[model samples]
Target chain A: MNSMTSAVLDEGKVVLETRQLTKSFGGLVAVNSANYRFIERQAHAIIGPNGAGKSTFVNLLTGHFPPSSGEILFKGQRITDFPAHKVSRLGVGRSYQKTNVFPVFTCFENCRLAAQAQLPTSMRFLRPAAMYKEVNERADWALDLCGLKSRGDRVAGSMSYGEQRQLEIGMVLATGPEILVLDEPLAGMGKEESERMVGLLKDLARRFTLILIEHDMDAVFSIAEVLTVMVNGTVLESGPVETIRASKAVQDAYLGDGAEAY
Target chain B: MSRLPRSLSILLSVAIILLGAYPLFGDVLFPNKHAFLMQKLTGIMIMAVMAMSLDLLVGVAGLVSMGHAAFFGLGGYMLAMLSPEYSAANLWVVLPAALVVVAIASAMVGYLSIRTSGIYFIMVTLAFGQMGFYFFNDSKLAGGSDGAYIMVKPAVEILGVSLLNLGDKRTLYYVGLGALVGVYLLLRVVLASPFGRVVSAIGVNENRVRGLGFDPVAYKLLAFTIGGTIAGLAGFLAAIQYGFVNPATLSWHHSGEALVMVILGGMGTLFGPAIGAFVFELAKMGFESVTEHWLLPMGAMIIGIVLLLPKGVGGLLLQLFSGRSKMEGGQ
Candidate 1:
């Protein structure tokens, strides 16, 4: 598909733009100066080897940790210094590499909380939250999207690894972000589960903007319209799948070193 | 239409009604010997309010404060200092003034302490409580370590006729009971509110709360301040009931005692701390009457309870009720 067609398919419009965003831990730089843009309504993938500072980039973009120096714009507004939640509300939602969820809460309650975040005020005391129709409806919608409708009452911690990963994504989606950042949505899933997840993710891209971080080459190639390859916290290459696949440098730096092992 | 279980609700309402009418029945039930029991019950009710306030932060918000008693004691001392004569003549002026002072003090403490989390939060609160304790203990102007005595009880006047005499044991019992019920209802309202859900969510996962477009720190600070204010209210009533105030009221041990009460009854349940406070105080009183080594038995009981009942008394009761429901469903 052409870039415009891909953009139209994904409802987001240049939701996140970063210029020379950098973060350092003491003398060692975790994420060097890098410029990137997540276009409106597209499944953009960022693939890199270990220690490529991909997580750091996600952290800086999401306001998990402040950047040393750079500019980040969300929906054309500067949000470099906004706290994590503020960035999220600005239409940038992210899922963690490590599953972060409310373990004790049921799957339904977890999603309900995410839905509740968008409410005008979470400070309304004197009314039962469960009785709120909007919250329940939205939470159910999220559960349906994540394919966890039947497991709504199950405690989050009790879900299988694959289901937990799907729930994590669902939790992020529940926040209704313009740009949904999935930090390895298929990290530890088996073959069938991974294929199922890719199909689900592809379906999601039609309705939402997605910035996917993945090490799974086949999945990335099949789903991503634009692929950005990173090595040591800097972009090695960026282009269509055919262009990236043809690049010898990307192969040598990332794939060539035991493509079979990965 | 089917409703939620009625038995627990019925039991709660019956308990509240019986407690409300305790003053009227005390004379008939116990004859000339009801005064002491009534006074002790009132004291337990006051402590319950204080425990409930602490639970808002510790149990619901996942903030373990070791110095909640500082706010409680500060409330009492503020009232005593404001009413130097403790005369019933100007209770209208004294009570509100005391509450305002305590609220401000607790708010300041919460604001400063909330910046730190985990052990740091606990330590900072403890430090503040100690500072408050020493400040009162060393200051002779507010009667110092010797403490101050209430020469007169504050009376509630309505159209030239007082609804109840503060000096009367029955009247004080009703007042204490009223505070307990009012605080319980208010807390229940808060728990059911969106803000309370956010606070509970923060306890469950701070990062997720933030990811949902909330500043967790801001919510936590708000919860801490509100909890402190409620504790201060309890302190205000405690001083009036006792007719005395002392630096010991703000001591670290008092704060520790409150924590124990929250844990003993159950965390996160509204009435858990109240139940804990009542049982704890009664056990302490009864144990002490039997032996000088009461603390040994108390310590053993706490350890046993912690090990045997991880969810506290409230959770166990919930389990039992839910279990019974399931069995009935099978039949």
Candidate 2:
């Protein structure tokens, strides 16, 4: 497993790093020369105010957007030029801020599509899709992990929003990623659904390396081993959760209602 | 979207049976008009095959191709060119040649068209199809606007012994039926395959599919090529049936009509488009027999169908057959 060679978050080896990475749309700089490092096995949370470069930063790492300039390295291998599919194949699975599950397909099929991507090529034509025993097992594993095992036969579109969010995470899990990038696992969720997702995240933290972008302070504080705070397309503060919470500069940056939440 | 109801499935099976056994009772059923009716039925079946192939792109892959007839016409042209002036060409030799030529043409067109999506895709494919049309229409070498003809129809022959003669209307009718059935089964199997699941998945959500780590373009191209190859098969059969290959076959009008058939019968279901071809042609003939101006009535009927049955006749049948008519029909 590449996981064996990669850092254990405690072992102090960087799994993903961005160096002077930048993205600009016309004159507006979305992500401006931001440098960030994510260690393996750590649950890292990125928190920022609205319009902060958090989403753009994640897009760069996942290869959804090729940076205007700079570089990204995964397990010390240069991956800045890779496209989204290639980046994903390199064990960097990402869940969208918006729910992106296949709507008309059943929940099982949604997860199956993700699991099927692990196959060397999905160009296989002669054999029936159902005959892939290992892929089916992987899908079941993901579904059970995401707590949607019983809802396997249900169509994704017909499901509640909370359930669709769970399926979103479920799809990323089916990809068997070494490091997971979740844009917002708790956005627009009710208290109970949020708690369930928080519990799921806590459980996942023990196994896979995670990079999360979430506005929910309580969940962030409880789950993250380290936190990176961004403001206006740049990193403001980043360190252990306790250290960032105590920093005067970090406090000043969050002046007003944002400071009270912190 | 799921399984058809038992009764409706049985009804489809009976239709197949009737189509297969029609020749046996043709003389008794139509008497003096038997030969004419058989030829007409054969024509419907060939169109059905073309419609079924187009459904692969429109229904399954969610790629609306406006140049589908370019591939269809190429297949017919292949048969015409391959056929000897004084003797019938061997079916084995001519079929593969036509299929290969059309396959290459479609791959090139698909490769180019895939670069553009949405309305641009439609325009690009149409442009390519029109190029084919004008090339055949303006060039006198291939018979110009008058089109080319196969003087001797293709027959399955091996070692100088003729096994099946497509020149005979009865033989051609059964052959066309065979092609329709073969294409149906092939598509059904393909849809159930892993490749098919990805293509259909592309239709629903391409971005999500890309996020899942599959190259959407490669999948789309493969689906397009397969559809084109099958459409060519229909065109090849059309050439043999009519003993002619014309520029109109490659026209955008032909592609638009085939697309209409796909939407009319039901875009997603294979059986729907084939049934669409059958119904569309019969309706045309019925209208033609009644009035000199058939296009006006046919146009009105198509408009009525699109307005009333948004999912097409195949979709309506799917709802009824799957027993979800009441719950889903209002939608």
Candidate 3:
């Protein structure tokens, strides 16, 4: 995994690059100046303790939180000040830390809405929504990919928590994004569910650029080829998974929280 | 997929056919009854259109407005101002003129109002409605407090063919009915469209919709404009029905009552508002004939209905029929 990651990075395969990204709320600087480059079609896991700015970092990249001063380039094109919708239309999709979905709508409807978002005729007033065959097909493909094909008719709110998380990611997939930002996709899941999500993430990383923020260390280590450890509003270190695991600073700041007991 | 449920589609079709055929035997059906039945039905149809128009904003787009009556009054005022007695016009001339005028006014209002959400949106809409109300109430150009009269009902002759004689009461009644059905179909098609999906999606989770590359404001503004235009049509019918336009048409109370009807019928359900209008208007007439203080019983009945059916009569009907129809599960 490390050799593969370095090879991809060396080949100039960077898809999303941020330079000196900074965000502040009054006296509290949620994210300090951070420079990073994410390789194309690679799973990059961001791990940190509470208030370590991992979420804020993801937010900055995805346009949920505007950086105080920074430049974000997607595929070498400047997207520093683009709104979330504009960024999304440029094929960058993201899921929230909290499962955000149209709860009253069915799984299929939720996916279909996402799929129809970027279509030219999405605003057509007289055409039936079901008549959009491409959108429907994309939604179906996303559902199948997320293992929600059988549960497509179920109302989103009624679905189990783990399934809701899957649906959240599935919605982003339905949008046909080239890059995906999964903000704590595996949060609050049971052992079996987290493992299942980890497997799904591994499979997705092959076809899509994945930037994940997760607290599950085991899952992170299992699937993430590259690791970026954030601590106290700054990036402590970023490198291959093994280098992060071997770093003394990373061990002391995050991995070493209860290392002695283990 | 079917646009409506099997039961609902059948019910809707039967209702439209029955209402369409009502004018044919209207005299024989109620020979001994009051001759004002056709006139009353026309009034009810106008209110139904208004109610449904508001539903597009409140139920589908999640925009609760308190000044929809402004558009209603705008249409009426246009008709009164453009009447033969006032400015010499025909139906073909006034209808589009009124719609265009209302569309511009609604666009201006919606552009400002759509920026606000929830209670602020309601207040903004109410303020706009009052602005229109006071303008007509204080202006002497349209008769002010005494209101203005549209003496000529505006003839409808298309290219020398007398397709509709608006001067006749039966003709006006049929036209009103046709307008009601036409507006209903128009809204139905829109609600089923991709635009409607986005509008409903906005109503659910606007942030999520935004994340999916959809701008909720544009869809919402479009909905507001369409809704306002349809309400303007209702206002035009009302003006034709009574040959009068007044400040009361644009009153905040009128907007409030329309909101009440939308809620009472079911906000998101397309057919609910019309059902709500029917029940509300008929009940008002029934109660008014029996007692002077009709509001007491009317209030109690509405409260009872609200408590009993939280989703409204249309929702209740949907729930009852949806159990047997698997096709309506997602919708």
Chain A TM-score compared with the true chain A, each model in order: 0.92, 0.94, 0.94
Q: Put down candidate 1 lDDT per residue, B40-130, tens digits, no spaces.
A: 9999999999999998999889999988999999888877877747356467877778777777887788889887889999999999999
Which candidate leads the pack in lDDT? 2
Quote each prediction's TM-score: 0.92, 0.96, 0.94
User: lDDT tens string, model 1, A58-148?
Assistant: 9898999999998887756778999998888887889988888888778988898888876876877667777788888888899999899
Superposed by TM-score, candidate 3 places the C-alpha of residue B264 at a distance from the truth, in angstroms, of 0.7
Candidate 1 scores an fnat of 0.78
iRMSD values, candidates in order: 1.3, 0.9, 0.8
Evaluate model 2 with DockQ and give the value. 0.78
lDDT ranking, best first: 2, 3, 1
- lDDT of prediction 2: 0.89
Candidate 3 structure quality by residue, lDDT tens digits, B1-331: 1245688778878987887787777778898653587788889888999999999999988999999999999999999988878443678888999999999999999999998998899999999999999999999879997899987768777787777768788888888888888898988898888899999888888888889998788899999999999999999889988989899999999998898899899988878899899889889999999999999999998999899989999988787777544566733
DockQ by candidate, in order: 0.67, 0.78, 0.78
Against the reference, the lDDT scores of all candidates come to 0.84, 0.89, 0.87
> Model 3, which residues run further than 4 Å from truth?
A1-11, A257-262, B24-29, B86-88, B324-331
Instruction: Write down the worst ten-residue block by lDDT for model 3 chain B.
Output: B322-331
Model 1 deviation from the true structure expressed as Cα RMSD, one decimal place: 4.1
State how far residue B26 of model 3 sits from its true place (Å). Answer: 4.5
* 1 versus 3: better DockQ goes to: 3
Give the per-residue lDDT digits (tens) of candidate 2, residues A145-236: 99999999998999988899999999999988999999998999999999999999999888888999998888988899999989999999
The candidate with the higher TM-score, 2 or 3, is 2
